[model samples]
Target chain A: MKRLKPSLVFIFLVMPCSLLVAFTYYPAIKSLFSSFWNQGTSRRPSKFVGLENYQTLLADDVLAQILWNNALYALVTIPISIGLSIGMALLVNSKIKGTSLMRLSFFLPTMLPMIAVANIWLFFYAPGIGLISQIMQYFGFEPINFLGDASTSLWSMIVVAIWKESGLFMIFYLAALQAVPANLKEAAKIEGASGIQVFFDVVLPLLKPTTIFVAVNALINSFRLIDHVIVMTEGGPNNSSALLLYYIYEVTFAYRDFAYGSALTVFLVALLGLMALFQFKILDKKAHYQ
Target chain B: MKSTINRIAYSTLAISLATVWGFPFIYSLWAAFHEEKYSANFTWNAPLTLENFATVWAAAPFSLYFTNTVILTLIILASNLILCTLVAYAFARYKFPGAGLLFSFIMVQLLITPDILIVENYNTLAKIGLIDTIFGITLPYLTSAFGIFLLRQTFKTVPISLDEAAQVEGANTWRVLWDVYVPLAKPTYLAYALVSISFQWNNFLWPLIVTNSPEVRPITVGLSIFATVESGVEWALVNAATLLSTAPLVILFLIFQRRFVANFMRAGIK
Candidate 1:
């Protein structure tokens, strides 16, 4: 292979690298820099306040609530969605009748925009005359407001996240499941393992890497994806369903508080950086097998 | 007898789960097709009408939103393809100083996406006078780290012999890439394109932050605005609008159902 000239390589790299620097790296560094400052208005010019924003972040009650809400959201949604996806993958991969139809039903939600999904689910969680309410009425029960009530709003968001995400993860699991050596399962069966035992013992362990992959993706998504909260509840009923990103959105865009928003963004970047660390560690391990 | 019973039970479980998974979309369809009165009232004889759809289409600039979304998605997709291809080829074939460090910087973007950097990005766009335009909406996403990564992996897999063989025929670098590398990475391109389209099409927050005009708003942001009116609830009209926004991708998924699944799998496992 011929070595390309340095100038040509520079030309090739300039556009994308410049854009990446302009958008991703520059914004990141700016956020970190601005987090040390305080928000300023025309009446009061901006002031340098080192560690003040972070100090306020430590004391901010709303930030605490938002962090707690996000943690719970991730904790609940990640495990349930992972479990459901594995089940869905196994189901679709099985020799079941109407598997194609089943797969379509499972995966179609993954194709829709999160905003559209939020819209459809908004109706389902509506106080009365909604589907769930109508079903509750049929069963001789009073309708409960899902998104309106603070207690259930976060949980409702969790359900939507699970529904929207599990199908996509199921595709990953399906790919992994298909790649699971057939002879391993056969050998397990030959050792008198039952179907459940074979799955638990042989298949599930092999899925550990996929599980970690999905978990990291889910963690990032739980931080990044707050469209449903914006659409359905708008983090309302006292900010019950507010995740970290939604809070940042509210602080930056809605409230027009840039410094605090920058602080929040820095915090979020740090949190996601941890997840990135975990992923690279796993990727390093996976690379050895290759 | 036990095996038969188990099969029946398993099928029932699978079918029931599918129903639960599909119920929300199915309900939206039902609401879209029915009158407002019949939206929540499931009846065997309820008349289906396109009236809600008509109202929805006339109510908002949905057609314009749809056009903007398509344009935005295509611009980003094309830009990602061309720019990432150039960058990925360099990374895959060339050994430049600081290449490893630069690649790691790109990988940082996979987790801390532009979505999370909204405030600063919005500030930057405002300073550049690109806010509220479709171009502003398309600017940050014109290239993506994942696309670069995927294409680089694909380009690296093309045998060096093929590059040498093409070069021996007096093919230039661009020609070698265009003819030899690009064609061979068709699957990667398709996978990247599909993933990029769906992502940019569905991207809401940044566009919502950047573009406030109907002419520039993508369907997701438009749909959010249309649905969030604090007035009396009109399930039929709202759902009609929802379906309208999602109809294109839904139809595409239906037509290329298997391909969508395969591409998603390929992209995800990467």
Candidate 2:
């Protein structure tokens, strides 16, 4: 019985995590292995064509375009979402009336599922009768193809992502904002510091850690921005808005090219790993202002 | 005078931003209730009705979708809570070999989200013959690395004296964990629970890939059916379906509005 207790603990802890590792890590490593091969649609054994897949990926114009699209998507959405979230955090953190209600209203969209929210926006983006088009028409402009035009489709998706995520980010900033020392702001005020100056010198510096946190999170989210794309665009209108992950989905599921999909997945996992490492190393170094 | 102008500017910016953020939602609520043929035209003159809601409810088996989602989310939640707490306790308290490696391995899971792994994961599920099953849908997320990390941080804050006291009273390690550590980590548990529930509740892609039929589809997947070409771009019905799909989480947010915000803040992921 005495020996059984520790063994039970070992089993309890190790077993569940092993299941997780089997489902998560095993496939991850398998994906790495599968990336080197050409296992498209046959029941044949995967014969790895060493680095050929990588060479092909480099030369693939579609892959290159998707990567460019993803980079642009990340660049545009991350900054806007973080900026808007900080703005929201500041607004709700103010000693204003109805602050709680404002917070709730802002954060409410984050609660809705992305698919559901995308559906609403999909209708809003519908051609002539959509809300934005109607508004545009009212303002003496021709109706624009928001989702149909490749130029605006990605941006439209970004708008939805920003709307969904900014409020959640605001909550984090608000928490960090509350942790800022009240006396420091008062001291800055007494030293003839304007509100903008105080914010720039004291508040912004104090909020740096939270900024790093938000930035890393936003970067991760930007990479994971496939849900809405799948629902709304499906990387459509001539693959103009084809983010990397959605492209991967198309390669594997829609096209039934497992090996190529695995190659794309490898690139994505490596990209995410680099992002996580960069976030931890760079952000954590700058995060320790205290 | 400049300060007054700044205040007005900030307030104006804040209000306008809030409206921009809040308007689509209000529009959705309006569209959900009203039976307007064309949703693109905005007018405040339309009378609201519940007919669209009734139509959406009858058009699809949203009740089954809700049940599947609830059951799947609960399964993931219960498993994550138990497994995460145990693993976190081990990491926090034990001096075992490879503990750091294992914990870092868990952290790697965060980097490879389900979206990145969807293709290979789908293949894996197909191999195991678990595709189209609720267990398959919920299994991958049943053990959360974020939950483990969060709880480990919370557990480390617990004083060693409590464990020693429990030991002196002849209680086992499990008993110490349950009676001492768990109680002390209630807020952390609650925070983790809320986060886990929210993630699973709103999860789309995995369920989309795993389940093939309406019987196993969750609310998100079921609602997506309305957006497909067969549904023919009926904006009012789509909004109605979406509102119904999101009703549970929205209702929960409304009820525990304060705690929801507090829990999110405490979770601290910006």
- Which numbered prediction scores highest in TM-score against the true structure? 1
Tens digits of per-residue lDDT for model 1, B1-270: 987888898999999999999999899999999999988889978998999888888888888999999999998999999999998898899877888898888878888888899989999999999999999999888879998888888788899999999989999989999999999988888878878888888999999999867788888887888887721458898899988888888787678677766765664464
Q: List, for all models, the DockQ compared with the true complex.
A: 0.71, 0.57
lDDT of 2 at A126: 80
TM-score, structure 2 vs. true? 0.95
Q: What lDDT is reached at residue A114 by model 1?
A: 94
Per-residue lDDT of model 2, residues A6-69, tens digit only: 6766655777788788778887899989888887445776786988888888899998888888
**lDDT of each residue in B1-270, candidate 2, tens digit only:** 987787788788777878888889988988888876636555678777898888878888889989999999999999998998888888888776566787888878776766568877898899989999999998788888888878888788788888888989999978988999999888778777777888888888778878898889988888787667435667788888888888888787678767766765654343
**Model-by-model lDDT, in order?**
0.88, 0.82
| Residue pair clashes in candidate 1 | none
CA lDDT for candidate 1:
0.88
What are the TM-scores, per candidate, against the unseen true structure?
A: 0.97, 0.95
Docking class of 1: medium
